[model samples]
Target: MNSLIRYQVEDGLALITLARPPVNALGQTLRAAVLDACQRAASDASVRAIILHGDGKLFSAGADISEFGSAASFAAPSLPDLLSRLTQLDKPLIAALSGLALGGGLELALACGYRIGEPSLRLGLPEISLGLLPGAGGTQRLPRLIGVAPALDMMISGLPIDANRALELGLLDRLAASADTLVEAARAFALDLLGDLAPARPQTPFAEPAASVAEDFFQQYRQTHEPRWKNRLAPRLVLAAVEAACVLPLQAGLERELALFKQAEDSAQSAALRHLFFAEREAGRIPGIAEDIALRPVARVAVIGAGTMGGGIAMNFANAGIPVVVLEQKSEALERGLANVRRNYESSVSRGKLNAEQLEQRMQLLVGTLDYADIADADLVIEAVFEKLEIKQQVFRTLDEVCKPGAILASNTSSLDVDAIAAVTRRPQDVIGLHFFSPANVMRLLEVVRARETAPDVLATTLRLAKRIGKVAVVSGVCFGFIGNRMLEPYNREAHRLVLEGATPARVDGVLTDLGLNMGALTMTDLAGIDVNFLVRDSNRSAFADDASYYRVGDALYSLGRYGQKTGRGFYLYEGRQRRDDDEVVALAERLASELQVERRLIGDAEIHDRCLFMLINEGIQLLDEGIALRAGDIDLVWTNGYGFPAWVGGPLHYAEQLGLDKVLDGIHRYRDSLGTYGQRWFQPAPLLERLVAAGKTRIEKI
Candidate 1:
């Protein structure tokens, strides 16, 4: 073995530690080193077994993300080859998994004959979320170890299961109760495996009936739960890979999985999702601000409203172990709000997600009262009341009156002026906008809107608070809808305009779905509830209809009282939440066109996608130009969080870059000249985009 592999004989067993630092990512260079180590152990006659482990807090964190999608490495036969070498080698290999065993890290363990883990260890295949799959035989090997159905759910969802779940699924051979015993237990398992004269685990050959059931179970599960996965390329491909394990030979299955991995990684979906994954890691940071921002601990949180958002926000805080107090207007309102909160908690309990004890514990922390006096000393107070100026003014006036002066006061205002929300209070410096998406506990994105008069500490506080409750907080300067909704204005406008021109609602949705959105543009409207969409439309109409044209589709639905899910009707009918295109809506489009004296012009899918998506991109550029968003990437983060902006699409601006800067500019101009001003705000390109276009730059990832 080369110098990278230390061939020390520990009682006739080989002890090979992966010396690469920082989670021992198995990039190309490290693969050669690992392969050499495995080969030397296999070749040595005295060595009966090998213990493979890492030096740091993790076994391995998969392939270095930096080398993810590239075609060729300077050295190494790819991640799959390295894993195959480990599995096929004569020496029985044991992996000591600690800290994080994810992606390629877990793949390595699967290749080994035996695996051991500590209680603190986390093992998962998170590639599906990044629009890639486990290329190193994770798909085939995992189901062979665990049952096919459980593996399908795990890999397809891309959510990490802890050590306990990993053990339940048979992913690990043995799990140590404590971290200290993990290595010893792993070594013992290795000895036991080496003692066996049976050959290494080859292709999985489960019984015939079980294999057939596995296929049926997986197919049914995908059809039932992820039928809408029509948009994402990875999920279906991952399902195919998992299915391959039951049929194909081990080596052929590995090859099939690798081909899918390479295909997904290079697909526009994977590139966009990977770009977003990196973008999110850097989203919270500001350039000039010190990396070590002293985050004040928000141990306890208080919400001024007990409405849906307020209750949801409280749940998020409580779920994170932070005590929450919900204050409402009157005794009746407080009681009703508290009831809603309890119902939410009980629902979780009924779902088996939480027990009665946990439900009670969380409910106990959520104290409800009519007075703001209870939360006067709270660390953070978020008001999630109605967006009405008067109602918000009253809440802030009361919050300022009773709450301790230093407590960060936040408003969950979607589009109201944060400056105005701040103006109602004496401590304007402490007031900020924590624009949590609806049902805050479920969403991952939080827009920390900074009012002009807000203090730097307050800005820092909301940013910190966002991360505390498990959200990607993007610092946004105050604007109508801040960043997410601001950009969405143009997107919906162009979608409506496309319908006006020649396409149907289904066609518009089709284009967006092909672009990788989870739902089509019209489908999203239906999902959000037509009434909810109408309310936003009316609000935007009152706010900017005079300056920019309002598409007539939304209000027309509102007039018919077809307000989406609640009414069981919308642009598309929702029959028990199964979305189907509405013929009535198509007729409405025709009627509206006739009323406006506009001829229906047939539009292509590309034009429909560009007009809708490019308008949003243009608006994002404007936000960047006006300094509403700190950087171009922040805008993308907001969209990924709040909107179903496909993480793979990398946000509107990133999509713009992918389409080519010149193309985006040309599309904007063409739409502007053809569609009028509401459509043309997009035609007026931002200086940064123009600069990039002039310089022939096509990617925002570099920035």
Candidate 2:
């Protein structure tokens, strides 16, 4: 018997326990063991039924993702073959699910005659997020149990449902009181089904939906979601598999689903999405910290300044069940900030995202305060005050006087120097940058800026805390804009220069959107507030003054008080919230072109895409070489999570690898020669990029 699977037969019942530690991911070894267990169960004369249960916290987290695209995944006793063997067993089989039974785990359960789940179990087929569908009979078996529409929605959304919902959907045969009792409950459930029928014959026959209704549903789903998926083929392939299940016999549908799965698995989209999946997990790892490093407990959190950023930051702790004290200088500002938080929660309730009770519970965790003394006991104090050095210094100095000795001090600064901010406080080790993007609670990315004097424990605790709040935390050495915004500087600068060189705002934005970006640089600038970018540029004037045309369009917009969506005019005019092309803005761009002595000329979409994207990719190469980012994967995670970089593109670094370093370097040189001094200044290839090309390296990992 394999150690991963413990099998025993007693009282006419065979028990097969998946004893793998952590998540019992369905790997080749585990699959082989499972198949052997089924064969042994079938041979035992005393065994009337079999129960399958995992020994650890979860049944499984699904397929061992590391095995994907590897030879091991296709080895003997593969998941599909093992599941087929289980289906062919003479004895009845019951799947005892607990914690998480997702993807392949869920598929395994579907293959069983019965499924008994813990009440708190999380169940789903979430392979869609990784740009693949549940390949192992999920497409065929799921719709056979649940209705076609619900099954399609579940797989399409790639979200997990609780045990109660799973039971309601006819996915679970029974629900156990708790995970601890799930195995016993499965045995009890199996007793009722003993000697019922042969294992090859399923209890519930596959039901085909009406052709008209099924066709309508599939067509509607495709028409509505195909555009959003952009260039990706996984979603469309998933839809095709589910459609096959509705029309074909079980065996035929399974074969068709297998074909589609193989197609999706081989696509570049799947590979890139898989890269990001691993990158997100890898971002949490730090260089010096041990896995067992003690983390500081953050039970109470204090957020200074109840503005938009502060209020959002407070919600993160409040949602995590930590008490938060939101401090503001004035009562009116405090009330206003609290009101916005309430409205945000209320909006979520209206959207069916949060229950009223949950909203109340989270709001109760928040305490509005005007006194520093009120937050003296906070375990963590974060200042989301005005983005000025002196303003932040004063807040930290006050915190130094009031906060307890061991409290963590974090600044939510996007571009400011963490070392400079740490100088104001006595405890520099505790003063780290917890840079949360705007609408902090909603954004998944959190750059945990490690300062020069930051303690290892501080970083360890912050990384742990970020996970608690459902964030993807990537560590960075402190610098202007850290990682995401630092690279974004050149990317945005090129967008502005493109407009001045005669590309319309609509054309520039259209080019990027066609390249699979969520929005164009000009569109994002308008949404982020044009005046905000102007201020960021204004503060860094000394560093950027050598280039006269640096954000000339932004300076002109700021001078005209055209502050984007807020002011209803920036790069484009706005009606309510929708943007419209403004002739005035276009005329302004032409004026800047004349002032800069650059002839206004037509630019192709390919050039627009390459110039902007390649510039961003080059900067990421520079950051990796400077050690500002720990790894190339870290840069990928930062851009994909923090900025709106498309996950399918893998991120600037990974995308550069796909485009080839030699091609990127050649394009940069061409731009430098064509545009003279300005292009020479901005488009000089990073040393790392040149070296990677010289060495004939193709991947970002090689660099």
Candidate 3:
């Protein structure tokens, strides 16, 4: 018996157990062992049937993603070949599933003659998430077991279905009464099959669609889903593979699916998506913090200030079933803040995201307060007051006096120095920054800013708490704007500069939106309120280049009280949620250009795209070089999740790699030479970028 596989035969039944701990990922070694065990069972005269089960929690999560793009993935007896051999076995083959059976693991179960699962089973074909379709007979076999619609939904959505739903869809032959008896139930099922007490339920080539597929279903599916998956390759290919199963035979469909899978696997989109797949996991790793570090308990959280951000922050803990206290200086502000939280929860209930009971339950977890003493006992307290430095310092000093020892004090500051804020608190080791994006309860990204004296346990606890609250957390060293906003400075500068250089606000935004950003720069600023951005810029004015033209358009807009959507005008005129181009904003930009003695010139889309994105990429490289970001991948996670940077292109650094480091350097150099002093100051390539290109390297790894 192979070490990865355990084989045993008893009472005319051969049992094959996948012995890999954790998720039993179907790697090359495990595939070969499984094939060997099946061959032995076929040759043994005493074995009348065979049952396959995973030794622990999950049957398998999927193919071993670590082996992707490596020789081990394509070694002899690949997943497809092993599954094919299992289908050809003469004896009854049963798959006993518990926990998760995803991607190739589910494909393995589909290849078996019978599948018996525990009620806890979560089955899915989620290869599409990695920018690849299911290659190991999943696309071909899934539609045969269920119909075309449900199979396509499962593959495209990359979500798992519970065992009860799987049984309803005919994906499972039977579910065990309980998890503990899953294998025993599978053994009983195999004996029934061997003794001819139950009908043989062969699934591979013999399975048929549970219902007839509509002739126009494929076309309608494309029409409905194509817009959502624009610029994405894997989802389109998955639709084709599922459609092929409806018309073609199983063998032909399998071949077609493999071809599509290989095509998607080789594409740049898949490569980028795979980069993020690993990057999200890699972002949690802190170099100095050991994996075994004890974590601080965050049982009760407190948020100071009953403003928009504070209310949103409090909701995060409330939704996570943690008790939270909202502190405000005035009772009216506290009432308004709690009312906003209730309205947000009510909106969710109306949208069917929560039931009435869940809404009330979450609201019950939140407590309104007017006293700092009331929040002194909280395990964690986050200050979301005004963004001024002195104001934050005062709050920290007060917290230091009233808060219990070892209680964490976190700031929701976006660009302000966290180390300076920590200086106010005597327990600097307990102080950190948790920069939550606006509408914090809704956004997915959370920047866990580690201060200079931040203890390892606090950092670990915050990372864990971020997961508990359903946020994608990335650690960053203390710096202005940390990771996401720090890089956004240059990108936004270019957008504002481009508008001043005779590119209309619409034109500049349109170029970036066409490149796959969720929204244009100006549009995002407008939504976030231009006045807010203007204040942020003014607060960090000392960091700007010594030029009057920098962000002049935004400053002008703020001066005129045209505060984005709230004021009905800023970069664009807004009527409700719809925005229209305003001639006054364009005229204002032209006036600023004339006043600054800068010549106006038409900017093409290509220049606009290259300048904005390359500068963003350049700043990311600088962040990596300065050790503000731990790795190149961490920057990718910050941009993709926090900002509207397209996930399909990966993060800016990953996009730079795909665009070629040499080309990125050349673009920066071209602008630096062409734009005189301004370009010379801002467009000079980062030392790391220059080094990578000089070394003839195409990939951007950590400096």
On TM-score, the candidate that comes out on top is: 2
Q: Candidate 1's error at 494, in angstroms?
A: 2.9
* Cα TM-score per model: 0.88, 0.98, 0.95
How many residue pairs clash in each candidate at the backbone level? 4, 0, 0
- Tens-digit lDDT track of model 2 for 327-387: 9999999999999999999999999999999999999999999999999999999999998
Give the per-residue lDDT of model 1 (tens digit) for 71-172.
Answer: 552147687888887877776677888888888888988888777899999988999888988888888888777767777778987888889888877777
Evaluated against the true structure, the overall lDDT of model 2 is: 0.88
> In model 2, which residue pairs have backbone atoms overlapping below 3 Å?
none
Ranking by lDDT: 3, 2, 1
The most accurate candidate by lDDT is 3
Q: List the residue pairs that clash in candidate 1.
A: 273-648, 530-563, 530-564, 531-563
For 344-444, candidate 3 gives per-residue lDDT tens digits of 99999999889999999999999999999999899999999999999999999999999999999999999899999999889999999999998899999
- lDDT (Cα, 0-100) at 100 in candidate 1: 84
